[model samples]
Target: MQELTTLKLIERISTLLRAEQRKKYSALGLQPVHIQTLDYLASCNRFSDTPAAVTDYLGLTKGTVSQTLQVLERKGYLEKQQDAADKRSVHLKILAPGQKLLKSITPFDVFIKAEQAIANKQFDSITAALYEALVALQNVNGTSSFGQCKNCITFSEENDHYYCLLMQQPLDQADIEKICREFISVTNSGLV
Candidate 1:
């Protein structure tokens, strides 16, 4: 038997997931982009919740992301909060309604069932392989990894507390778990 190319495997999985997402979100007057935006906002760290970050993450034009954000805000899916320290920068906060909608539409059950069907060792192996592939692509594309803070090179644990050496700031549990735009994976050593 022959192995499928990485691109083929990734694309096929993406197409299937996208089709399901489109079907699930369409009933709620949401496009895949909208659902995608909500999902990103839900998982991103505070520093990565801005519209500019969203634009970068989605690889969409600023205008397009801005419009999508405005629509979500107007429809009660999210809110734009002015940054306390930066007068010009804004943060996108996913509201309760958005969370509810996302929960209702997400096919978590499908993923749970899939996970249950797979052997534990096989699941772990597949996850590791996929992560390596993702990191490789991100490196080749020169894109931000958006990895969890705990997995970043800048992440430091002192005693019982967490700190970000890059930002010279303390990090909470929530901060360590969420995706950070400035994440530099620990695997990429020899950096400042």
Candidate 2:
């Protein structure tokens, strides 16, 4: 038998994970894209809470994202609000029901068991390796990084205050942890 290449292993793992997700989604009468949009909204910062960002992150068409958003909104999973600054733009906000649904559907047992099995250092190493692989793939595809605001080159901390130079806005602790679509890699800002 041939040895599995890195890409093959990753693809197999992804397929298994998606299969698990599909089961949970089907039980709740939700599609994979619906769950993905909810998950993204839950993690993304204010700057990345728009349909355009969702479309970019999911690599889906505007029409598809629009329909998904409409369904989620109609189902009381999310709300679409006109941006205060940009009246023409809208922001997607996951509601409490969406949060509850996400919590119920999240696959935590596998991750919990994996964490319990791996040493802290080993887990950290694995995380770093996976992040590197994701970066490589994103670079190849010219896709948005959607990295944590705290990890971006534009992030700064001073006197207990967090700020994003790129956005020219102050960030709270929660905001700092949320993912940003405009994330500039701290290690590869020049390349970005």
Candidate 3:
């Protein structure tokens, strides 16, 4: 019963954190989805140097990823080039403008603002407790064949954290193995 209650609280906190990111990212001309795509592209060292590597890492539906790539390309945030080794394939590379933008934007600012709503240093305690609960849950979920964030379609680096744009949640290694449909890998590279 105690564990159940803690899980419930974590769920609620997750929802609130998501809503906060939505509101903040929206203002930057990005929805969580856009951030996810960008985040994935930036994470892999290869993709960091060759943007087109994003498609391979993400395993996205070709058409959907292509469309998203076009949007980013058109926006001048990414550059596309034909692969030298495989002329039939294209490579996407993050441009100077894109890096500049990502460096300037982060949803953590919202987290800090929300933290102010609590009193007496309670926020830290709550956050720490929640993390502990999540770790406990992970132990139960982690014994599977796959880790969530590592294998997820939407897991991506965002502002120093692994974010899932589809579920609007952070990706945990354990959660990915559960094959949860709500989560996907995300990116934080297009923010600034």
* Structural similarity to truth (TM-score) of each candidate: 0.58, 0.58, 0.50
Model 2 over residues 91-171: C-alpha lDDT tens digits?
999999999999987764544444443334332344454555545444443556676788888989999999999999999
Q: lDDT score of model 3?
A: 0.55
Give the candidate number with the greatest lDDT: 2
* TM-score of candidate 2 to 2 decimals: 0.58
Superposed by TM-score, candidate 3 places the C-alpha of residue 55 at a distance from the truth, in angstroms, of: 5.2
Clashing residue pairs, candidate 2? none
Q: RMSD for all candidates, in order, please.
A: 18.9, 19.2, 16.6
Of 2 and 3, which scores higher on lDDT? 2
Better of 1 and 3 by lDDT: 1
Query: Among all windows of ten consecutive residues in candidate 2, which has the lowest summed lDDT?
Result: 115-124
lDDT of 1 by residue, 111-149 (tens): 444444332433234545555454544454355666778
lDDT score, candidate 1, position 46 = 99
